[model samples]
Target: MGATPVQAAEDGRVNRDKLRELIGRMTLEEKVGQLFVMRVYGHSATAPDQVDIDHNLEEIGVRSAAELIAKYHVGGIIYFAWAHNTRDPHQIADLSNGIQKSGLQQTTPVPLLISTDQEHGIVCRVGKPATLMPGAMALGAGGSTSDARRAAKIAGAELAAVGIRQNYAPVADVNVNPANPVIGVRSFGADPQAVAELVAAQVKGYQSGGVAATSKHFPGHGDTATDSHTGIPYIHHTREQWQELDAPPFEAAIAAGIDSIMTAHIVVPALDAAEDPATLSPPILTGILREQLGYDGVVVTDSLGMQGVRTKYGDDRVPVLALKAGVDQLLNPPDLAVAWNAVLAAVRGGELTEARLDESILRILELKARRGLFKQPYVTHKGVDRVVGTRSHLASADRIAEATTTLLVNEGGALPLSRRRQPNLLVVGADPASPSGSTGPPTTVLAKALTELGFTATALSTGTAPTAAKIDEAVAAASGKDAVIVGTYNVAAGSAQSTLVSRLAATGVPVVTVAIRNPYDVAQLSGQKATLAAYSWTDVELRAAARVIAGKAEPEGRLPVPVQRADDPTRTLYPIGYGLSY
Candidate 1:
């Protein structure tokens, strides 16, 4: 295997010799072509049958992706997982090899960069068996830098197996607001310092394992209650406040040598709200990042299709605005023609001078050279087997699944439910019949794990108000049983989903409320009953709850983010990295 990209660039320096040698050989158009990153819908060149393939080709303007890369001199491809695309991992590896072998149009022979959103551990790739590690919050709950490293390694190794070099991961946003719509479980925690440490570890793990890592949402997207994927999230912190809260993680990650930084589509009125979102803001991207933090590596934009940019800037002009603002690459351009025309027009119109374009291309080429793409042998199908997912990786994933579980609140020594004593129990789900269907996986896992323990468990789903009949049955079942488990799966945002908690609180039974998804929900019912947080929707979290509740194991996991009240207290709901173990 080749050296990790970090080591290749190690001397604490960028190699100017090799960089100049490569840049001297590229044509103006060819060099310009390498600046735009296009999204590929399918796994391989032969994927999705001929009809689907032909349509994608006609629409994108290139049949085989190899042909596209060669014809347009496109520099990179970002992969995604939609049901229509081939899901086979090996096939994806083959496709990547084809693009690499398409060769360079210029003398430098720069290999096309392959990137993907394997943020939650290779969500897109087919070769690697998936690791059900809890999301970012779980890692924050686990409060182990080692776990952060492990998650990054899991993501890095899987992506590298399929020939993907860049990973958009280790979301650096600090989840200060529990109600943050999109970045909930994706962020580290509310504290900037904790977020910095965890995110840095993740970046180190990925880079050390030979995959480049990107720390995202530049100024920070963790405090907003809105999702930028849907609309522009306006952050209200002043410059001093922003520096204190949102800027630390990016600074820490860059100091640790993370390869890429992704810009978010957030509006900061104090900064550049009138002109552009952060992704296309020269003041933020160029002035703040390039100047203040001293980030010299590639700067990538978030998906151009996001409503934040598409709604305001318009698809026809985002590429130019982003380029002039110091973005290194346009990621996931919705309309390639629009991006191409916009960029070309910028150059012709002198809005984006040739010198500026060359500067961005130079950094990209430097990254490619550092990755040893120009020197290493082109990957072939023969080596495809050697690189895809392996048995050892799957085992590592299973272990991580077990380590990231959190038990936020417990009472009645109700966890590690005793099968010998409370043999018969009523499982109150988010709804009256099935909890997993209504609220997600935490409560479902509790229900399933209890069943595995040889206890007689019946799952009842309930909404804001448990049906009169279902509540009566649950109350009747609780009368004879030793305990009643209510699965309340509420998120930080949205409605409080705990009708079972409310109903069971009214009853005299020893009620245990398992917060399957949000920590805030557990906080809401603090005075009523025993509450615990699984922090995610994965199976491992449920099993962890099973072990703790069965008295077979102790609840060792803590809260990564603070849980607060409806009135919003000065302190968070649960303090950062707070956990209780018996």
Candidate 2:
């Protein structure tokens, strides 16, 4: 290793001399390894009980994650919901510590960047022990950047305490398409300006709390109807339209000095004539994101396991293509060993230059240095319990949830449902079947909260979509009730939920429809006497909705996206910023 005299600047930037010296000492294999971020679990694959069943280890040509770390010298490890299966904060901390120890045992001893998809709300990968807040759309509905900043700070602090230095969150995509299967509630709002402000605030909050905030799915994935996880969704907007709608938030993120940006797999024909997804298109990644937007931070690709990228480029080729397109880190590459060897081959074959590879490695090293990982790379088990899901953090979550409950419609003052009357309430659509396997707070939370407020509340859930028989059963049950509170989750997917609510409303019981997930459910169930948008099915949001119904807490949330009327798709029933209070 050649040592150059490079001093640390006044701004505490990474010393160029130290970065170059570290690069000088690394072999080509080690340098290639630094560009890949792999996923790991708590247990070792080579263990007697775990052998042959460890598919991840089998693909990577390593018997154990520790062995992979020592040999491959991967730059980072990402934890998904499956990785945190133990659910115990102490166990999670131990796992993180173990990984860091193994990284230190390597010849180069570069610290691994511990990361997770802790986007909070329904998308939280680490559940229970982590404080669950209403996600991005709810924060936008609350209409307070300060609250968004506070929520991010609390989330960032908890993640940092558990040794997770990077959070793939604060989704900057604008939810302009209501039929958008994936980014609906995950986005901040339909308006670009509002989304930009909140995204910037979240970036500031995350960095302030010692965790790198990632503004994700660059060039926007919000307007497309398809989910990128399943296929390549094309965004058919021109450059002028992108500037007016999608590009503003990302521009704001760069200005906020976001630590990282994750690329979407969607194709933008206007940006690149080649039919390649943004992940493999230099015109989109290097040209638009780097040159046009002037983003100097690390650019990471979304999981290569996703079909969007997998269908076009197999696991063996996606990593090299992403590197050629200027992505600094390859997140969740399909096969670590194959991707690593492929990149090594590319450099040797002159497909990729060593100088180009060094640029990404330097950026990755700078990120690790900026996070102060070299000083303290491990976290204590006690720290996890102290910071994760503390009372104060939960309180912030509750406040945001309460503030985000938007009452979109209230016919004949049906809201503030007279708790004094002790009305018999039939609660429908509380626990719908989730296709994505997301677990929310208990369905009984809303019924229990309403019951405590002097109203007799009965809860019923007929999965994601109810059959005709189920609808009849619900209507029969609601016959004698004084009021009906029907909770709808993603009614746009099918007519079953809307049909049930419309039928129940026809029974002449003051029907109060609450949008449990998608706010656009209001447009479908227009016959309901009252409509509310809870945005998420989390406990805090459910309880907040119940309180608003009982006149306990005033709803302060506004619609973050427009609701297209069911009768006419061209017409919007409720515009953005539409909300009512008690």
Candidate 3:
């Protein structure tokens, strides 16, 4: 006998008859609308009406997000930092409910797949009150798939409580290149197998917590030096090389039944000879991803507004090309109406067949159904408040942070600063302003935590990077201190901060360097008496780092990425899985 055919129900369960009925009822415009995911600002009353044209198409400006839903019928909505204007859980829930309610008011009334880039750790788009968990690298450093699963579950539950059905997270990229500016700490680790194991575990946890997990920047964006948000990154690797290095995690994601897979905006000439990005390349998206890898889930493009896609294809052509290249959904199109109309025109002109459009729409609809969004599209305010940033979740985050604090170097045994002696410590480099736009843990919090641990701690910031004069001033201030702890955020990018630490280490005083963002900072300040990797500057992680420094807690994390020595870039000082305890 043949295999039984599955069905989809109106509530988005497996009821094939209902799915066929709904798809048959959708018009061409509605089908085209299902291919685009647009962005919305805060819950402000003012409608965005500023219009401009690029490449012979008028940009779509709206008075409100409701207008976009009612008029264009977008398939989904992605929230950015702007949309999360307030940190209040109830207010954020109300915003999500409002967006979903507006979609219901539309003629077709298909529920929107509300999504956000809540990849906790360094890349949290949604601001405060959301439990700040460690990033992917931190999970890998912790060396436990169970921690990855637990952290993802907590994050997924918090997001789901706010009516978010999808999280564009658990980046599958393997950060093999230390110079990789964009994906360093975001990736789980440098080893493909390790990343695969952790990625699969996170996928299961996210799905178990009721949010659809999206394995992102598919194939991989780990080995490049460029940021896709700014420009196109080229990856030079043969097909076999890519499969061995970058394909494992994505394969694991598919095996774990991830609901969505996002396309990278980078160019891989080995995959496709064309200069076009993966987001617009048929060979990369359709041929390799669909045919070779056998990813049958909804394939989404990275933000269409990114320079990687926008610079090559204008606003008018991006959506059409993306749809033609087998993308199921266009994320953050430059102009929603223009992109929607262009797709409609493509189908009408036979440039894209109605059957082709339906293929993606069906996948998207299936995902919505699988997520049970059709059943409960809105979340209650009380539910959001109760689950989001709950005490238990925060405690989990704290434990994860502490578990991921790595002691990379402690030659002089500067750590576990003798509590009985009560060292007079001067803490520096806790910049409140994160260069990545993330609100990191404040310097005051670290100082307060240390003070509570019976140390006389003083906190100071040299902004992002301190100058020579500022370094000299800091050294003078540290003249009488028993120990100096310098917090470095993204030291890989800031040479001045590294120099300041080096100068402090040269002063012959005990200097403990804490890398607050990337673990690679240890390579620059290897001369320090002690070096620690926190991986994130969030409140929980900073407090955990302080606790480890004071011997209140032990460092348990291993290094996730290789660190090149400061004196020799060719030599790796600390390889993956290298860490120490007091």
Question: Candidate 1 vs. truth: CA RMSD?
Answer: 4.6
Identify the superior model by lDDT, candidate 1 or candidate 3: 3
For all candidates in order, the CA lDDT equals 0.70, 0.82, 0.81
lDDT of 3 at 84: 39
Query: Residues 1-582, candidate 1, lDDT per residue (tens digit)?
Result: 232222224343567665665566677667677898777555564334566567567667765566567666778987765522325556667767666766443244567888877665212233223444556776777778887797678667656656777888879998888778888777877889988999899999988766789999897998898888899889988888899999999999998888889999998877775657898788999899999889889999999888887778778788888888889988888778778777887788888887788899888877776555655524544455554445665455545555555666666555655676557777775632322111243445567788787777766665544566766666666676666787665533334444445666667667877666667776556334466676654555566666666766656677777777655666566676677666
The best candidate in terms of TM-score = 2
Clashes of 3: 8
Model 1 stretches astray by more than 4 angstroms: 1-15, 54-64, 83-86, 103-109, 121-128, 273-275, 377-403, 421-487, 491-496, 504-510, 526-529, 567-573
lDDT of 3 at 407: 96
* TM-score comparison, 1 vs 3, better candidate: 3
The alpha-carbon RMSD values of the candidates against the true structure, listed in the order shown, are 4.6, 3.2, 4.5
Tens digits of per-residue lDDT, candidate 2, 505-539, equal 88999898888888988776657988989888777
* lDDT of candidate 3 over 286-349, digit per residue (tens): 8988999898999999899888888887788999998888899899887776788888888888
Structure candidate 3, residue pairs in collision: 7-14, 7-15, 7-16, 8-15, 8-16, 9-15, 12-369, 47-63
**Candidate 2 vs candidate 3, lDDT winner:** 2
Candidate 3's TM-score: 0.93
